[model samples]
Target: MSFVAPWFLVALLLVPAAAAVYVWWERRRTRGAEPWATAPLMPSVTRGGSRRHRHVAPAIYLLAAAVLIVALARPQHDVTKKIEQATVMLVTDRSGSMRSADLKPNRMEAVKAAASSFLDQVPAQIRVGALAFNQKTKLLASPTTDRARVKNALNTLTGAGSTATGDALAAALAIVRPQGAAGVQTPAAVVLLSDGANVRGRDPIALARRAGRLKVPVYTIALGTDEGTLTSKRANGTTKTERVPPDREAMRQIADASGGTTSDAPTTEALQAVYKRLGSAVAEQPGKDQLTSLPVGIALVLLVVGAGVSLRLTGRIV
Candidate 1:
């Protein structure tokens, strides 16, 4: 156990001195005692409940002193191994159809929540950027390690326009390709969250094919349950959910063509699974070395032992 401030150890020298003073005082008190036929009974009388409580006092003092000394040395702990730096980019759909409430609240809201969690779990070394798209895709932030900016960009998005899978994919890859160092990992990836509705530009399948050639894996998150539902607000107030078209399988195919697997999770939980899988499948880079857990653990042991000793001296066995 390394000390944050080693000077605190000087306090321990007081323990032996305090013990000597206690022994000296005990011997001086006994020197004046009178001899008696019931001399052995004296110990029993002194050992009654009240006397027992006093027996714990010395231990308590020792324990308190120990705690104070340990507290003087600060401690900290970390168990998880550190990860290396990496870059990740995401392309998400904000098409008009994403406004559907099939995924609860709406598809886009669910996507936003899932994206935020994924971003939060990513190691600090990983640079992440995001793209939000409808008719035309827009780069909300360049690939950056400043996570707050990426998440802020995600939260500000609102759904509108028609779905354009091709333009969005091409544009997102454009953002990822140049950011990578020569011979270093593409470091960039594309996670497309949509219902597989490709209406605005080129064919989505063709884009997926292009991604496969570019070594970019396009992971797809298919949103909605069987017999999908949609909610739209009318001019006269009030809202309602009605059965809408379902297109889960098409999204899955997009994933397959792009060398990425697809899974169905109609709720926010699905998005979580998707993001977790992405993290697990991807590899991290390299960086700085630091310590963890060892120092904190030693301090904890000392604290527990001192506390136990103090409690035992208080008349109850620890």
Candidate 2:
């Protein structure tokens, strides 16, 4: 907790001062007792109950005063708050290799499920966009707060052509970047999921460097196992098996160049976990919350209780 006006806490000193005054008055009253003619015959006049009980009302009043003083200082505390506004571009690989059945039903279906779950977990205030890439890149959905639209786009994804990772990143950046002459930058991020190495389109490393210059992080997720394979048809009326494993090193390099993180997900569950972590990173921010009202409310309740106890116990309210 922090205080906006810390000097107001100095008022707390009055509580101890009042306590001292009450003690002194009580002592004086005891010392100044009037003399009695038949002192031995007179019954003792001291209060018979516990002496500590007499000070309850005064103690409550002092505590209320201290609380109110602290409230006047305008205390604050650090709190975890969701991001008010942000843009997230989801770039997914729709290359033929994504059809591999290594991850459950298929890589593409697994990716879609994990991505949908990620979208659901994202805060409503964040705007999300979708882009699918193969031999070419296409924007499936523009940035918007309507998550249903993004999910709809994800459902329409299909695997075909070759991996165009660079073009996909560029398209994602174009969608997330602000459009104006002033070129004002907003808080934005990109999440790329791929199951194969780049085989077509522009240079992914160059695109990552450009994204870094624009201060946009491009988190990369490599989704596949080393033993993954894809069956392809040859021109001579025959089929051949091709190894299509996730290029983790390339993805890591791209992420590093763009000032982002990289992860490898061999299964759908691991992919979803990675997405959940990324959602937390992009959807929430650190903030401070003012707690002055809390203390003030507590002080008000204490004041009422103190007055009620004083009136019930003693004949007058403190």
lDDT of 2 by residue, 1-318 (tens): 889899998988988998899889867654555354244432234332234665788889889989999999999999887778789999999999998989988899999999988998888889999999998999899999999999999999878889889989988877777562237777788999998889888999999988888877899999989989999889998999999999999899999999899999999899999999998888764668999899999999999998888777664675
Worst 10 residues of 1 by lDDT: 283-292
Clash count (model 2, backbone only): 0
Clashing pairs in 1: 56-313, 84-285
- Best model number under lDDT: 2
Sequence-dependent TM-score of model 1: 0.56
Q: How close to the true structure is residue 96 of candidate 1, measured as C-alpha lDDT?
A: 62
TM-score of each: 0.56, 0.64
Residues 183-268, candidate 1: write the lDDT tens digits.
Answer: 55544467777764777687778878777766677777777666666667778898877664436676777787877767776776
Superposition error at 19 for model 1 (Å): 81
Clashing pairs in 2: none
